[model samples]
Target: MHTGDLAVMRKDAYIEIVGRIKDVIIRGGENIYPREIEEFLYAHPKIAEVQVVGVPHERYREKVLAGVIPRDQADPLTLEELRAFCEGRLAHYEIPSRLRILASFPMTVSGRVRKIELREEPARER
Candidate 1:
């Protein structure tokens, strides 16, 4: 099933899968929700879809990161704007430390998002 469908089914069953069990980042004692960040990005008109993941951090143990796909290919949103948008909707700790804009997400044969691969894609070059 699609993520949205699964989410609705889970809600109906009263089972809340807070985050991808494997994607939750423990940074400085905080539990960061990557979905929250992705949802915030989805609110923007320019964004088509988003995915957020956790990556290892040298100091804080782990850090939040985001990958975005734009609805309009020519007018992609910037990382700073995306971060600012997220800041308005999320707690400080939930904001992503790194952001990337992609043309499309990698998907499985059945069309499920390949989140494991997403989590492993190298961070955008600074």
Candidate 2:
């Protein structure tokens, strides 16, 4: 299962794709998938969209960082708010250690958020 593509086999011998793998965060030797965290964040009323990324870390090799776009641009969500929302629902390692709540995400002509670029760019202060 390269990239952790989740699929379910049908009785008739077909497979269905449920979810595709997003970037993986390795913290203290554990591998955490971003999509799971992203899905959990989506349930929050304030979070309009979110993308989780792995940022460079000296001790753990990588840490979880979330690029979030709030439902209301004027009112932004904070790192604590998001962490509190994700508490208990998500594993400690799965929780975003860094939060970048932006008004809008950088996108491509195809309308897809550029995750690779996001991993490299510096985030604006809250």
Candidate 3:
């Protein structure tokens, strides 16, 4: 069924729903899954929480952006550091092109991250 859910069938015959079709980021003809990137970024010691979203880009149509909550407010994560950390770890296109340090992610009443709000945020705030 084409339910707009991105899933994978494991060798054990279990289906894993990774993300949604609408959430996929297409950059330079490459498909990037925010959930995959978010999972990888969760390993970063400096990152307490992270959300990956696609934003407008003239060249690629869309570009990867990361919203992160630093583990320590005193020592926030930097874009350079994030890129460096992603190097050799994630694909070139999968690396976040922009980084935003958010105090808290906009959430729904159900407690889900509001990605739509993130996409609508002003460039200055991002």
Best by lDDT: 3
Residues 1-126, candidate 1: write the lDDT tens digits: 545311224635776555665666788899776765676768888888988887777778778878788888888888787778777578878887777779988999999788777777653332
State the C-alpha lDDT per candidate: 0.74, 0.81, 0.93
Model 2 reaches what TM-score against the true structure? 0.79
Each candidate structure's TM-score, on Cα atoms with residue i matched to residue i, is 0.77, 0.79, 0.92
Clashes of each: 0, 0, 0
| Top candidate by TM-score | 3
- For each of the candidates, the C-alpha root-mean-square deviation to the true structure, in angstroms, is 4.6, 3.9, 1.7
Model 2, stretches more than 4 Å misplaced? Answer: 1-22, 122-126
Residue pairs with backbone overlap in model 1: none
Deviation of model 1 at 14, angstroms:
5.0
lDDT of 2 by residue, 1-126 (tens): 375786669899998764555566679999887777887889999999899888877788878889998999888898899889989988888888998878778899999888877777643322
